[model samples]
Target: MMVNDPNLFWFGCVLWLVIIWLIVSLRHSNKVDSPTESNTAGAREIEELRQECLRLREELQMQSKQLKTDFQNATFSQLQTLLNNYPSVRKMTEAKPDLPAKNLVSLFTSLDNLLASWGYEQIGSAWEQVPYNPQLHQPDTNDIAEGELVYIRFVGYREGSRILSPAKVSRTLPISSPSK
Candidate 1:
């Protein structure tokens, strides 16, 4: 083999330097690219976290609404039960003097609140003494007055405009004098 020329040797050295420089620069570039890739992944994770939070909030709202609906239904059902038990309660009151009237009144007021919560209310005029109307009064005829309603025996109830029950009334009657 011929001995290498000086110019050729110098060119070879220069070529080797260029190749080394390219290799080192490529390694550094790869290092920088990895951090950028990791940052992009981190950003994607944050976006996913945000989406999950939104989904949870929506679920909470739906559950809250459902709870409110269930509560209202339960309250209405309680009111219906209280109203249906009224006849039996009145009979018990007649049999037992020890049963407190105040306690019974408080229970009725609680029932009124329950009704009001579900958009029903005790009839206001039911408390006031009024003339007997066949349309408004349903009497058992056991308790008789004379001509018109002497008193409202129990409170009437309604839901909006629809009457739940007519007022139980006693009619006024003329007292006959003993024959002289």
Candidate 2:
């Protein structure tokens, strides 16, 4: 009967692989030990091929790293204008004057969508009240205690399980009173 059992199937594969390995190893050793000029030439060719493979592998790795750095630089350059306007954004959150907040909001929504596509997510919404968790929130003052209720003064971001920034938490909201 054919060894159709899954365990036997795997064992059979291992057994065949070991046998093939042994045969190849014996042949390779015999070739290396041969005193013939042709054997020496073949051995030199194999060494050269192995060295080329290593050199190519290292070059590929360097190119990959450079590409990654170039991508990061490009992203930062594109986002520089948005980053420069952060002070205005922070002020808008605090004492919002009769400015074009609607346009700013639309821009922020688009930015949020962009960040979401890049696997970044907001840790907490601006002015959102939540129980204090030191791991996720950075207190504004030393007076703040763990497990206490706090309002997020500034929203933070993260990618997967890694926190990019902790939400800036304060005892009071910067704007009009937020109901508990």
Candidate 3:
């Protein structure tokens, strides 16, 4: 029973070495788990940001579509009012021609200016004696003879590149001055 028996002391030293090894292994495991947990948290934050971006894009698209719809509805309503006012405004064109040429010239200019104010542009004119064109004019009668545009009652009106309405016209056979 020696207090410093070599076998017993060596056994105690070996036990202490085992205990140190266990503590070091537990510390290393905690370090590894800490990094892995941090990576998982980072990945979760990135996924949340992606979800938020997708939601914002959807909201922007919906707002853009609504704005487009509202604009179209407003344009249509304004166009309806314009069309309703057409007859009164059109009377100016017919009435101006009846005035004296000197007065009518100024009146005609004023009429053109007025039509411009209403978004109309006179593209070209046709004699009341030209051949009928279905593309340019809607014929009241297909049986009517060619070279006989009897009436170019109103000239075609256009806005930008689009025709709002074709000129209303009538056709007839050429007037024969009694061939003598």
Candidate 4:
């Protein structure tokens, strides 16, 4: 049947308008909800990545500390062994007073090699012909004179810029003339 009446035509137009408005509103709501949902998911992903980065940093710090501890332990053990053997080496040299100079040289070369491997060096000079400096040497007696080194009581050692030990020494004094 044809809708020839004015009232009926107006009702049909109103119904179609309501349907189009409902469709547009539903699409708009979906578009708005989609971004909100996607944003929430994005925020969760970003937080997870941040937590992972923090965990990795902590692990690296732990590994670095462990490596330092291990290195210190190894160095300590090596030094302990060297110190333990030092007395025997000294005794052997003292007992063999007539030992060849070349043999003594070889023995000192081996000792130097050992010290070098541990990042250490002998600090005192063999022939103390130079003037004594308070920074490098500790005077054994108060009467130690200025020029010549009389004797070395103990040898010193150095590691980099640090003085591990001081050289213990006695200096020669000029003899005083007897009054006539």
| Best-matching candidate per lDDT | 2
lDDT (Cα, 0-100) at 152 in candidate 1 = 49
Model 2 misplacement above 4 A:
1-51, 54-99, 177-180
Q: Is candidate 3 or candidate 4 better by lDDT?
A: 4
How does model 1 fare in lDDT? Answer: 0.56
Worst 10 residues of 3 by lDDT: 171-180
* TM values, all candidates: 0.39, 0.54, 0.32, 0.41
**Clashing residue pairs found in predicted model 3:** none
Give lDDT tens digits, candidate 2, residues 61-127: 6876787657745774577456334533645644555556635655566665666666766777767
- By TM-score, who's the top model here? 2
lDDT of 4 at 92: 43
Over all chains combined, what TM-score does candidate 4 have?
0.41
Q: Order of candidates by TM-score, top first?
A: 2, 4, 1, 3
User: Which pairs of residues collide in candidate 4?
Assistant: none
lDDT of 3 at 36: 78
Q: How close is candidate 1 to the true structure, as a TM-score?
A: 0.39
Candidate 1 lDDT over 124-146, as tens digits, reads 23224576655455665854544
